[model samples]
Target: MVIVGIEPTEQNEVQNHYNLFKLVRAPNLAPNQVAFRIPPNVNKLDIRDYLTHIYQIKVVDVRTMNYAAKRPVRKRDGAMRGKYVSKYKKAIVTLCDNFKYPPIPDKQSLDEYEDRAEITRMNFRRLRGWKPRPQRINMRKKERYEKFNDY
Candidate 1:
């Protein structure tokens, strides 16, 4: 029997492992550069190898920035106290080819999402004895209404 395409080799199997490389949007970056939120342990060499080997993309350069974790401060004493946010690393990778960012969702899709959220909220209220909390009143609208009532 003959097999089609490149056969799975031991090397391929070894390179098939998963690594966290989340693509992030950075409007300030150049067309050839892309930003990614990677694990703190991942280095520039690892990023270059991963992109070249897995995605078959030529990486020109990789720059990494480490962000320190933020600690919660006490409101009363103005002291640092509470759980710390996890530290993360951001990688700005420059590619040989230009990369175009994906388009944003239109207004119709946003309206549909709001409708679905409203339905879910109503369902939750029906199942549980949930009361709608009072929302903050807009000062402009309130003043306009007051002026109209005076007229």
Candidate 2:
């Protein structure tokens, strides 16, 4: 491997590794919006700054979300458990007006993006398979009224 400047050391290597982020492309997402996988502890302001300062990209907004590890189990009795999946964080960055992201040509990266997007779509609450039952309580139907007694 070719070293650019100083010889790479462990401390520098770890710091460099933290700079990694993957670009995710999806048909459902807006053109200006770019999705990427980042470290969980990273905040939105830092992400925005990273793109703008390091990558020279103008960012309008940065939205972040964390995905919990999917630990599968049996539906009937919840006894059988599958392999553990590590949780990860994803960032959806909105770029400045009319700025289009450079197309990623890496086939493997493209495929990974598709898989991540599909997983996210399935995990969405509105379209999820198992939905929580709506509460049928003493809620006002058409008019608002003060509670008469303890609920």
Candidate 3:
């Protein structure tokens, strides 16, 4: 019996692969350069490969900057405490071709996006049994004194 070999296609090569490369808006970036926020563990080679394979874009050069995690500080004593913020990396990829940034959404679209995001946040808080903070009312000094003087 004879067996035939099949070459892996681009789709087959990256089957079920998921990598987070968040596009960052950098107004100061050159037209040929694009910024992305990647995981700290991702290397320059990985970034190049990811962009080339996934986006079908040719990368000329990739520069990476790693940001250390920020430790939480106590509000009163100003001492470090609580959980530390997650570390992240930023990659500035120079492309073979000039890159044009996508157009910003209109006000209505932004409002809708914010509404959806707020709903998701509220759902998450509900799942975590989070309580909403009391709303504060702005008042004059005399009004505030009168309101609190009874207590």
Q: Kindly list the per-residue Cα lDDT of model 3 for residues 1-151, writing each as its tens digit.
A: 0001212245725543354677788989999998888778789988787667656789999999999998887777766688887899998999989987766668765646644665676678878998643232223334656977989
TM-scores, in order shown? 0.56, 0.50, 0.59
Ranking by lDDT: 1, 3, 2
- The model with the greater TM-score, 2 or 3, is 3
Estimate every model's Cα lDDT from 0 to 1: 0.72, 0.62, 0.70
Candidate 3: segments with Cα more than 4 A from true spot? 1-18, 77-84, 110-151
Model 3 scores a C-alpha lDDT of: 0.70
Best-matching candidate per lDDT: 1
Q: Lowest-lDDT window of 10 residues in candidate 3? A: 1-10
TM-score-wise, the better of 1 and 2 is: 1
lDDT of 1: 0.72
Clashing pairs in 3: none
What value does the lDDT take at residue 77 in candidate 2? 78
Off by over 4 Å in 1: 1-18, 77-84, 105-151
User: Can you give the lDDT of residue 90 in candidate 2?
Assistant: 89
